[model samples]
Target: MEITLVEGDITAQRVDAIVNAANSSLLGGGGVDGAIHRKGGPAILEECRALRASRYRDGLPIGQAVATTGGNLPARWVIHTVGPVFSSGEDRSVLLRDCYANSLQVADVLAASSVAFPLISAGVYGWPVEDAVRQALTVLNAVDPAHVTEARLVLFGADTYTVAERVAAGFS
Candidate 1:
């Protein structure tokens, strides 16, 4: 798979799937979650609500993912994955890794050749941006190329853009 780093709004990406760093509730919280919700429109929340009503528990461990409509975003689908809060400890890394893994799995299942991701849990979740970038690249490298043809790390700021670029370059 090809990896790239770009500075922009993740919600605006034209990939087949765009990931949302969602809360366990899938109800929409701050940071990337809020932005996605805002751009995708209230219909996204309505779908999330329906999922919750159907007994979709928040027990989706960190790293696991579920699919939803893109709402008003350019992408066709939204993959909602719960990421561990940094204070959750080293065990959280496994969940974070699963977050990336499950995301790719969902993308493959959706036949999505291109996917865009925000730095999962790096914002209010307090994951260090540098470490998060490294971990993301590590996980991305582990994915089979047939599963995802293109992946882009969409960053909201210069610092995050720099970190993602450095980590992606290290893989080269």
Candidate 2:
């Protein structure tokens, strides 16, 4: 898949799918999760509630991903994945990478051609920004999805976007 970086709100991306850096709860929290929930409207939450009631009675586990309606957002679907929190004492990079990989898997299953993703765990979860970019690219670059044609890493700030662009250049 072709990978690109965009400096903007992920909720505004007009793609086949938008990935959410969700907490295990999946109901909604701060940062990207809250923005997606608020902008995507009630329909998205309704699906999440239903998922919680059925498949995810406890919560979405770290590294796993699931899909729901995008609702009012520009994207057609939303892929919610719980990112592992940054841990200086232990290596949780595998779980972090799984956030991107599993989300792409879910998108492919939904037959989505394009996906937009936020920098998972880089905000409130305290993951170092540069490494977060690298981890995201690591999974994204390796994937050969049957349906996904493009993946956009949507950065919320100019600084983050610049870092993503610089980190992305290394992959070239």
What is each predicted model's overall lDDT from 0 to 1?
0.87, 0.95
Q: Please write out the lDDT profile of model 1 over residues 1-172, one tens digit for every residue.
A: 9888889999989999999999988889888999999989998999889888785854455677988999899999999999988974365777787888899899999989999999998998898888888888888877885667999888999978987777777664
**lDDT per residue (tens digit) for residues 50-162 in model 2:** 99999999999999999999999999999999999899999999999999999999999999999999999999999999999999999998999999999999999999999
Best by lDDT: 2
| Model 1 worst lDDT run, 10 consecutive residues | 55-64
TM-score for each of the candidates: 0.93, 0.98
lDDT of 1 at 104: 89
RMSD (Å) per prediction: 1.7, 0.8
TM-score for predicted model 1 compared with the true structure? 0.93
* Model 2: lDDT of residue 160: 96
